[model samples]
Target: MGVSSGGPGTGLLDRRVERGAVDRVLDRARAGNSAVLVVHGEPGIGKTVVLDYAVRRASASDLRVVRASGVESELELAYAALHQLCVPFIGPRLEQLPRPQRAALAVAFGLREGPAPDRFLVGLAVLSLLAAAAEDQPLACVVDDAQWLDRASVQCLVFAARRLLAEPIALIFAVRGPGGDPRGVRQLRALPDP
Candidate 1:
């Protein structure tokens, strides 16, 4: 089977079945509602493809998109995934964060020196940063291969995902599954090709 361009009559096998879910996420962001979508499937089952589609659609709709892929080799490094997601948003607005939150993120990113940060504090800081960015435009945070994320980054992301109410943000995680489900996030399972 070949991947389609997510359009009709293109003589391609579009991921029509998955489009609705992606649309719902985009719709929610456009309406200033926060949403978290977890796309789970085994390796080679198009989880990355679906994420790519969502990224394209989001960009076309003018949403600010940030993406991070968990590297198995970096699993032992603290805050690596979270740092990747924050890089684009890490300018002067970061200074607007509460002092503690700012310090925590700076320390995590190695942009400052400090004792270890509280994990929950780092999560809240991230949520605040994303919310601030979305104030100018809707924002989408996409993560692929989430199962390989460091424990610290995963904990922070999961905390932010659970508490994203009333923000114009969408959090999408695509994980290789049949295992490795992140608790408390909505799951969108990709159906196998017939």
Candidate 2:
């Protein structure tokens, strides 16, 4: 099914079938477990509707939610998605990260001058930052149209997703799929029309 552009509520038609998976993800996050869920389907298959449901549920449960969307035009810009995901959470909490990790993120975000960052280092920095934030409250990071994300952002985010254990954070990606799959992440493919 496709989402309607009229407004909220109007677009989430026929999405009951996807509710269970979203509930499970939210349940895991509430239990202090780290989780990553990828919801993939063909374009206009209501993936955004599912993501919106997750966001609403997470917010209702008091989880801190951070959202970002990848623009096709920004696909060439390194760390663009990561910047969007982490900018609101950046603050004194980032100072708690290991020195090198801190520097890596700063370099990537243009917050300071430094050598080009290692992708893994940046990813670890992201993981640490999310974990640190989670200590204050459970966190949910939502990325829409992840298929359009930059290569570097995808690498870093996937790295962070793989390492999310024992932390109260949930990383969710809504990607245009049915053909493309984000490597090494747990996937929940949406059903195609009959």
The model with the greatest TM-score is: 1
lDDT (tens digit, per residue) of candidate 1 on 1-194: 65666675434356676767887988898899998888888888888888988898899899899999999999999999999999999989889999989999999999999899999899999989988899999998999999899999999988888788888998988888764555665688886776
Q: Which parts of model 2 have CA positions greater than 4 angstroms off?
A: 1-11, 179-184
Q: Candidate 2 residues 1-194, lDDT tens each?
A: 44543346645655665667777877898899987888888898878978998898899899999999999999999999999999987889678899989999999999998878988899999989988899999998999999899999999988888788889888888989653555555788887644
Estimate the overall C-alpha local distance difference test score of candidate 2: 0.85
Candidates' C-alpha lDDT? 0.86, 0.85
**How does model 1 score by TM-score?**
0.92
Q: List the residue pairs that clash in candidate 1.
A: none
Cα TM-score per model: 0.92, 0.90
* Candidate 2: residue pairs that collide: none
**lDDT at 162 for candidate 2?**
79
Q: Which parts of model 1 have CA positions greater than 4 angstroms off? A: 1-5, 8-12, 179-184
